[model samples]
Target: MMGFGLSIEPQLWALLFAMVRIGAAFVAAPVFSAVSVPLPVRIALSGAIGVLVVNTAHIVAPPEIFSINTFLAVAAEALIGLALGFVLQIAFSAPMIASEVIGMGMGLGFANAVDPNSGHATPALGQFLSLLLTLLFLAVDGHLVLVDLVVRSYEVMPPGAWIAPQRLLNIAMFGGYAFLAGLLLALPVGFLLLCLNVVVGMLSRAAPALNLFAIGIPASLAMGIVAILLALPAMGDYMLVIIREALAAAPALVLG
Candidate 1:
C-alpha cells in the first residue's frame, strides 16, 4: 500500500495510531459526537481530521505497530479520546438537568418525547431546552471552538502518551460544577413555579369547588413560559459557563 505515492511503511502507522484518539472522542462527545449521528459519518469525519493531523503534526510511527508495547500506546490514545468526549458529554447535560427541574415544577415532568438529537425519550421541557441550547450553542460557533480544542489536544498530550492520575481526579471533580451550573440555570424558573404552586394551593383551600387541578395546570404552563422568558439571560450565562468548564476540563480528560 502507498499513501500520496509513497510506499506505506512504519511512518503510516503513526496516523493510524493517532486516529484512534480522534475517533473515540468524536464517537462519544455530545452535540457533534452524539450516537444519533450515523457511525459512517462520524468515522468519515474522524478520518478526514486524522489525515490533517498527521500532515500538520508530522507524527512518527512506532517501530512495530503490532508489538505489545505499540498496542498499549494505541490503547492509551483511545482512552484519551474517550475522556475528552466524556467531558463534552457532561457539559451537554446542563440543559437536561435544567429541563428536569423546570418540568417537574410545571407539572410537565411526565410529558416526554423522543429526542431526535440524542435518541432518548426526555421530558418535553427537557427536549425544548436541549434544542434551544443547541441552537444558541451553534450561534456562538461553539462547534468551531470544539474543533479547535480537539486540535490543540495533540499539542498538549501527544499520541501514545500516558495520562496522569490527577487528570482523572480532575474529571471527577468537574462533575460537581455540573450540578451547580444546572441548578443555577433552573433556579429562576423553579422558584417562580414554586411561588405559583403556593398561590394555587391557597386558592384551592379558599374555594374547594373551583377544581384546583383544572385551574393549576394552565396557570403553571403560562407562568413557566413567562419565567423562562425572564430567565433567558441567566440561562445563557450558565451555558457559557458550561462551555468554558468543558473546554478547561478537556485537557485533563484527554491527558489523564
Candidate 2:
C-alpha cells in the first residue's frame, strides 16, 4: 500500500468479486459458452467486464473472505448469473426444436451431424438452423445486449443478496416458451410437407405395385427443399423475433 499512491486492497477485492458474476454468466451463455471458446478468453473477457462494473457500480466485497456470509454471497452471485444466461439458452433451443419437426416431416430426421458449437450430434437441419440463429444473434448485437442485462442486473439484485425464490420459479416456467415458439416456426414448412405426404399416400394406394419406399423418400426430399426455400424469409423474420423476445425476457428475471 505504501509503494502505490492509492490502496489496492479494497478495489482489487471488489474487482475479483465482480468477476465471479461475469464469469458465471459467460459459462452459461451461448456464444461465449461455445466449446470452441477458450477458457483464458472467457476469463479475460469476464475480467474486463468486471473492471467496468467495479468502476460504475458499488460492489463491496465481504470483509471476511472466509466467512459463511461471503460463501452465501458468492452463491447468490452465481445464481443470478446462471438465471440470466439460462433464459437465453432456452430461447436458443427453439431453433433446434423447429428443425426437428421440419426434419422429420422432410424425412431428413435420420441425417445427423456434430454441431461445432455444442459438440453434440444434432440433425443436420438443426445444425444449419442453429448456426443461422447464432449468426443473426451476433448481427443484431445480442451478445452485447445480454452483457448489458448482466451489468444492469446489479441495480436489481446487487451482490450478496439472494434472489427471490419466485424469480427462480418463473425462470423454470419459461421452458414451455421454447416448444410453442418452435412449433410456430416450423408450421409453414411442416404444413406443406404434410400436404406432400398425403398426396404420396394417395398415390401409393392408387398404384399398389408402385414401390412407395423408393418414391416417397425422393418426393419428400425434393419437396422439403422447395418448402424450406419458400419459407426462408418467414423463418428468418421469426428468428429475429425470437432473439428480441429472448433479450426482452432476460431483463424481467432481474429487473422489476
Candidate 3:
C-alpha cells in the first residue's frame, strides 16, 4: 500500500498572505516596532500569528499567487494592515507632542537624549513622557487588544476586499483627536510655565542687576519637575483613554 502525500498548496498560500498582512501591521505599530525588538523575533512573531490566523479563518487561497489579481489582493492586505497600525501609532504619539510643548515651556527642550523606543534624538522630557505612555500602554494590555482587533479584521474584511474611501476619511478625521488629547495633557504644565515666565519677565524688568537667564532656567526646571509629578496620574488616565479610542477605531479603519 502506498502512503498519500498531503497537499500543501492552499496552506502555503494562506500562510504567505497572512504573514504579509501581520508583518506590515507590526512594522507600522508601536511597541512591536521598537528598535529594542530584534528583527528575527519580530519576524517569528509575525509568522506565528499568521499561521494561527490562517488556520482559524480558513482563508481561501487565490487561484494563482503569481497573477496580477493575486498581487493586487496582497497589496490590499498590506494597505489594510498599515492603516490599522497607523491609527495606533498616531494615538501613541500624543505624549510625545505634549512633552515637546511642556519641555519647551520648562526650558528642557535643549536637554536631548537618544530614545530607546525610536532610536532618535529627543528632549529628555519628551523621552520621559514617552516612557510613561509606553508603560501605560502595556499595563492596560493595549498590545493584546490590538492583536485581537487585527485578528477580528479577517472576519470583517476578508482578503481581497478594498478599503472604502469613507473609512480612509474616518481615519484622517480620527487623527485630529490625538492632537486634542496631547494639548489636554500639556495644558496644566504649559499654563504654569507660562505664568512663571510672565513673573520672571516682570522681575527682570523690575530689577536690572538680577540675572534672569540663570535664575529662570533653574526655577523652570524645578517647577516643571514638580508639575510633572503632580500631573503624572492625570496623564496616565488620558493615555488610557487615547489607547482605548485608538483600538476602538481600528475596526472601522480595517473593516470599513
Best by lDDT: 2
Return the TM-score for candidate 2, rounded to 2 decimals.
Answer: 0.96
By lDDT: ranked, best first: 2, 3, 1
Candidate 1 on 86-161: residue-level lDDT in tens? 8877778888888888988888888998888877888888777777777777777777776677777788777767
TM-score against truth, every candidate:
0.89, 0.96, 0.93
Clashing residue pairs, backbone N/CA/C < 3 A, model 3:
none
Where is the poorest 10-residue window by lDDT in model 1?
Answer: 1-10
Q: Check candidate 1 and list the clashing pairs.
A: none
TM-score of 1: 0.89
**Candidate 3 residue spans exceeding 4 A from truth:** 1-6
Task: Give the poorly placed runs of model 1, Cα more than 4 Å off.
Answer: 1-6, 208-210, 252-256
Candidate 2 C-alpha lDDT tens digits along 1-256: 5856347777887888998889998988789999999999999999999999999888889988899999999988988888788889999999899999999988888999888889999999988888899999999999999888889888777887877888888888999999999999999999999998899889988998999889998888898999989999999999999999999987786454
- The RMSD (Cα, Å) of candidate 2 is 1.5
For all candidates in order, the CA lDDT equals 0.79, 0.89, 0.85
lDDT of 3 at 19: 81
Counting clashing residue pairs in each candidate, in order, gives: 0, 0, 0
